[model samples]
Target: MTKADFVRRCRWLIACAVLFASANAWADEKSELKEKALKLNSITGKDPIDGKIKELAKDAENTKKMLKVAAEVAKEKPQPFQYNGAFILARAARELKENEIALEFFNISTQLAMKVKSASKLLESFDGKISLLYEQKKFDEAEKACQELLDLEIDPKFEEAKIIVLEQMIQFKAKQGKIEEALKLTDNLMKLDEGGWYFVRLKGWVLHEAGKYKESAETYLDTIKKLSENKRLKEEEKERWIERTRYILSSVYVDMGQIDQAAEQLQMLLKKKPDHPTYNNDLGYIWADRNMNLDESEKLIRKALEEDRKQRKKEGVEKDKDNAAYLDSLGWVLFKKKQYAEAKKYLLDAVKDEDGQHIEILDHLADVHMALGEKKEAIAVWKKALDTEPASKRDLKRLEEVQKKLKAAEGK
Candidate 1:
């Protein structure tokens, strides 16, 4: 109520107003920058972040515009926009092959995300960083980054991140031919996420990749059992899992030359899902390959090809021709039955189709040519098969066989 008291109070109110106005101005500026950044991010397609940059890079002026806006937003240093902007810049630099700049911004973004206690952003940034490092073939740095990610505080909600990091570690180790070390990490992941069927399957996949066929088969069987008991999956889901695992199991059995075991697995799968084209073709092919039950194998293969055509039609896809794999299976079974002319027709379609020309399919085509005494055609088909890149153990074996065949043909 006194004069001096009122003046002092008015001064304090003025100071408070100034501070509030300053805060509002700062917020307004931050919001504007965020809007600009969001707009830019949206226009950059959902392809790989670097893909956006590569496409954008095709137009230098637009790239310059986005780069400027992103840099300005990054300078804002607000809680989240700063980190988001840094990510954009990093992607752009990465695509531009400015490796040092990209790496620097990636580090900044991840560290900023951590400072804000955002677990999801941190994980995402870690993924981006590791992916960039991997793309650059800097395995050693990526390995170290994986270690750093593992060392972080993993809240239970984000505990899954630990497995992701381990997977990356296993991948690089596997790439470097450290199969034993990769196996150990996969084991660690299996133990950590044993409750999940996917992890158990991962272990079997690693073993299979390492050519441990017997162990892969055993592990897949174990996962099938574990998945069966999981109670989380209803009967239908469990049946689906069993059918798929058994399909994989059959492959390992075949690889180990346990032909009977493989046939049994495929038979079980067919019993459960009679219309599954893959299982039907696999069983038919296995039987024919082993020179057993040729008539039944041909029937199974026909049924598979028919089912596949029906499925494709239902899906609104054109099935004017047979599926390449199914055709190949039918061709093989007919070859086994010494019906070479009929087999040749199907095998020729397979070799000339878009989804066909698979090395094994080509090999089968070549074999059919040889059966028909078309030596020139056989040599040409075998040469084509040899030019195909072998992607698996089976394909590699076919390649080796083709190499021998080529040598024999040359000598003759």
Candidate 2:
């Protein structure tokens, strides 16, 4: 061989040897990283793994460093290591609340997870995506993700996750004011567990909101009966269910204008827990508004206020800044007793604190003002109240009376 050709061959040999050594070193480094990750996974509860994950996520400089390392490693190995690295990065991103980065990582994880047939990992990724979409109020995307989960054919072991997604879909439909769609979805949930109290309660709430009070009351009654028979539940839980059922039934009766029936239900509730302020307030306010049993209404309302104060003091809880309903009840009761000054004070307090412009409170305040001969203020409050009154015959009649009073006050 010629000297020139031999020299060229020697150089080529050296280059190839250097390349092989570098590749071997890179492989060793990657193997070491994998071992370290396994060690991390082996650590027990209260370890620094979660902290390490969080720290890595917040270190944007380190994330770029790791991503570059991942790209290089992926170029060299191009298999399982790439998937593992991507998943680790995704977890870190999620911990940092960098959802866009997390989503990108999740998409890569989904592809890798599917390739490995890692059902749990895939489900986790899908769940993260669905939750992100839901938080963003992207209901269409959230629904799509939910559908993807259902399509995955995940085992019954993940039943709770599946049910959560189903419930989310139902809630989304309900929020969109699609009551019929929500009801249909609820029926599907019921079919999943024929006698599920949770589903029954959900159906009752939806029906009540949709103005199907009779059906709602029946559903609530059935739920109460079923829950009562379930000896497996604790006493506290059973009591909660009973209270919920009675509360719904009472509300339905009130809506139907069956005040006597509502009063009866409230009486039963009070018998169970005589200090239930809501029940006391509602029942007393109903009677006071109708100008019936003025003395008893006053007693009940005062009892409610006393109960609330006692409970707050016992629990070391802060009192609400605005007790508008309680004040309104007190004011109306005092008005019935012809104590105009005392009634005006409480009603005005309610009107001032109720920043949401509560029509009922405004009406009561106007009535008190009229009694106190504050003609201008009474006319203003009455006009404001009338503006918000529902378009019903009874409300229209009240509006007419207010207008007549306003005209008389104006000397028209």
Candidate 3:
């Protein structure tokens, strides 16, 4: 699923919990404040809060009373109810975007859980803390929490939490650009998990990040075969993994300077999903980048753009015809074919849509301007790109190229 769909699917479980109307916990339970909250719920009768006004206690007065009672129970009860109350409060705090309070309450809930049972029963709750920290971009804190969690002797029931924490720690490390650290965690996970195509696919990703193109290519090829043979994964799941592995394989083979192998991989994908916009764009960009099959590349890029527009419209969203990356592909292809003015239009559209911060898009725009003899515009764009590029070897090389272009232009 797309990111938006994933969020929608899980939103109710996290933020908008349907308060238990069943004889579960809340129904069999009663405190003075809890009764007050329920009374308000009956009176309100579903004006808002999804027919469950008890989720918010209807108004501030009852909400305040509920908070006080929850706090008291958390201190005085020291058992199952305290754990339950803290979890509810944490969910409330999360909805309010009070990250610190949410984390504090979740940790409190876990601590209270240990008092109820000899072994920890709150790793799932502890997971809420990790997610909150990651959402707030507290990567270091999140990773530290992961390490602390792994250090604990979690119950066999909660052993699955270990895998979750490890994956989260790896994600945090990767987000902070510590790819090698993430690779080590991936290796650990591979050992812990039952052997599957998933780990093999992840190994390919790590190899690609480390710039081991030949190894990445080999692993990705293996990943496809393993994905096909894996009976545990559903057909849709296998399809996604296989397609992604094939795409990566093509890119890796291209980096290995085996263009024929790259072409064959892409051709294989297109045969399965002929109108796949992403594959069309990737193949188009590859041929454009290599300055081969210029006419065919143009056709493929245009088709990709057209398909994207149709798909977006069908999905009930704006068509976004000026998508910067696709425009860049088309513009670059046109420029390679010496169609300078036509290329200039598409490049400017790309820069406009990308808002001038995308390094490669700005570079393409600057080059187009230079080709059009618009020296002043070209120099300005090059300087902007130079300032915006990040501190990486590839980006530093981009900076140097921009600097060289600026210097050469000024000299004339």
Candidate 4:
């Protein structure tokens, strides 16, 4: 063959070989991508064929790079792609704690998701914003965002979100110490869903703090009953509700001077949580004050003190002041047993170390000092007690009587 003809034939063969290799490589890549797309689709529960098509389309940059290399020797083609890439990117940004990036992406996602009519995606974007505001402690901003969501009529479908928003409002009001506003919010919350036991419990706490003890007790009982009726409540939750209700009932009964009822409720509570320090101390102190169950009271009080010490040690907490009620109970019990000197030490310590300037602690201290013949100290403490603002007419009368005795003793 001629030299030019041989060179031309050789060039044609090289070009054909290059084109054949490029086509085979493209086919192999396409098959591998299809397999990957199918696996992702199956796992994600999306349409396999559509997923494959979208994957090919969205990876245009990578595909373009491949196609450019192939185009040097053969024709290149593009694949179709359609997926919420912006939404996915936004979610990734949020997960990484890149709030600025997340905000940008979320805005884009919201716009795109709205066009797609994806309610769930739109809700997610709003929730992300709400959560960010809340995490920043921007309560007013968070509330505004929550209100916006509510205005969108999302609450009817997102009942959990609605409940959360209501709870947040209640918490915000409570934290501000706006008890009346909190109660009003609680009432509105209850009207929205009367069967929600959490709202009932919140209402009870509000009433308790407002000194409506009887109403608080009734609400607590209702909360307990409602929680018990909820099949979705875990066993632990039900037990907690019962324990809380019983504890509140006991406290209210004690406040109302219904000692027998208080004792009954406390007994039930103690049975469930035998070593509960506060309950043990309160029940023991109550019994001692009533001059009933002295032996049991002493035992319970000692146990409570031990538990308190253990808990304080664990939590690295220090109570610089004495527990006035605990000391008063111990002192009164010692006086009942005629251990006058020992009673005087505890009562004096209680009066000296008590916070809140408790009148009852001072009264006990004065009475103990009188019994111990420390007449001057007794008179001083009695006068101090009389100076305190009495909560009731009975307390005022008692104060007056104590003062009269102190004056008579001083005169003598």
TM-score per candidate, chains pooled: 0.65, 0.57, 0.64, 0.50
Per-residue lDDT value at 194 in model 2: 78
* CA displacement after TM-score superposition, residue 365 of candidate 2 (Å): 1.1
RMSD of each: 16.5, 15.4, 14.7, 21.7
Leading candidate by lDDT: 1
Residue by residue across 201-248, what tens digits does model 3's lDDT show? 777777776777788888888889888998998899889888888988
What does the lDDT come to for candidate 3? 0.73
Q: Which should have the higher lDDT, number 1 or number 4?
A: 1
- Going through the candidates in order, what is the number of backbone clashes in each? 0, 0, 0, 0
- CA-lDDT, candidates in order: 0.79, 0.73, 0.73, 0.67
Task: Encode model 4's per-residue lDDT on 156-229: one tens digit a residue.
Answer: 45655566666666655553456788899899878877677878888987776566778887887888788889
TM-score-wise, the better of 3 and 4 is 3
Question: CA lDDT of 320 in candidate 1?
Answer: 72
Clashing pairs in 4: none
lDDT of 2 at 283: 88
Q: What does candidate 2's lDDT look like per residue over 187-277, in tens digits?
A: 8888887766878888887787677778887888888888888778899988888887888788887777788988888899999988889
Candidate order by TM-score, decreasing, is 1, 3, 2, 4
lDDT, residue 400, candidate 2: 71
